[model samples]
Target: MNMEFTPDQLQRYHRQMILRELGAAGQQKISDAKVFIAGAGGLGSPAGYYLAAAGIGTLAIADNDLVELSNLQRQIAHNTERIGMLKSDSAQSTFKALNPEVNIISITQRIIAENVAELIRDFDIVVDCTDNFAVRYLLNDACVLMNKPLVSGAVAGFKGHLTTIIPGQGHCFRCIFEEMPPDAEEPSCRQAGVLGAFAGVIGAMQAMEVLKLVTGAGEPLKNTLLIYDGLKSEFRRVNAPRNKDCPVCGDDPYITIPGC
Candidate 1:
């Protein structure tokens, strides 16, 4: 990929380019990066929006769900007019309009273990905006095996959390939470009801994490978990250490075992 920026790109991204930490070199890095976003609902919507506007070279969005009336509350990227459209397709349309310079690819199928690795194989980084633990676990394991960076975020009710998982560099999700909790034990937004802007806040943070990872502008959430309580408007950062015996990222990683 050419690292040179065009006149149009320079003008479009002049503001960010002026930042001492993210000058032309950093902007070029962002322009040459490919990002894989896994789901296009509340978190994906805002995260993808910022990345699109920031001129991320290629953004591949994968989501199987179609937009619903309920999604409009926090899915700022989709509208009532796109209610029935596949979320990925809808997100593509919105992103393309926001920044025509970027390449936006949309995948409209459910992400399964069989296809997840191949889907994100070429991307530099993976962002987890998935709503369920099933897909999240699938991505966490796949990214660890593939040695890719994973930026994950989730929100429920008025609380949310995010963390950056750099395979071998920091903690993998499995090291933090050994197993997926039962769905009934952790209610979803539908039952718990998240505030709209709360999702936006966390999603935007995920976007910032992606940009930082791509440009090396700032320290990402590596080895740390950030929790946000919207009701109290507070943010907390806790140390996240990788467990040497973590099943997915341990010395004897389970990913190497076939069908274990």
Candidate 2:
């Protein structure tokens, strides 16, 4: 890896570069990292923003939905002027503007089993920023099958949580939650409004985890789930063990595709 930084690049990331853990070498790794984010909503907005600012070389954001007025409450990457615009397009514009050094790929399509592999195959990291459990499970199984690192985050009302999965190093999402919860059991942001800026807190944490993963700095939440409670202003970490019987990451794997 060349890992050379131009004068402009050096100045752009001077703050992070000065850190002993992530000097120019770490910045170079970040500059070479490719990240695939599955949604451009609340969590994705802030998570993608920090990644862009950190100058991740290639950032591909996938979203089939259009920006809505309701999304403005937490999806900070999109503004009032961009209402009705495709979420991926909106995120592309925002991230590109924030850091022209980043090459942003905006995919305006829903991720399906047929295409999810190719969608995230080339990326170094896969971020689960989608809202619903279906998309969550789809990304989890796909990443496990593909052996890609996954940084998953979720928020409902005033609570949010995140976990990192490095294949064979720790518990996979399926290991912790074997099956998607019943639809009626899932509390969505739409039904239970997320606290404003709370997504920022959680999303920023997600971004930090990504940075750690790329730069090889601090811990990356492997085998542990971190939960945040906005109302109580509390953060907790719980061990998540890999289930030997996990269908996706187990000895006899089962899930070969999405929705299977």
Candidates in order, TM-scores: namely 0.95, 0.96
lDDT of 2 by residue, 15-126 (tens): 9999999998899899889999989999999999999999999999999999999899889999999999999999999999999999999998788877888788899999
Clash counts per candidate, in order, are 0, 0
TM-score of model number 1: 0.95
lDDT of 1: 0.90
- In candidate 1, list every pair of residues with a backbone clash: none
Model 2: residue 225 alpha-carbon error in angstroms: 0.8
- lDDT, residue 129, candidate 1: 94
lDDT of 2 at 6: 91
RMSD list, candidates in order = 2.1, 1.8
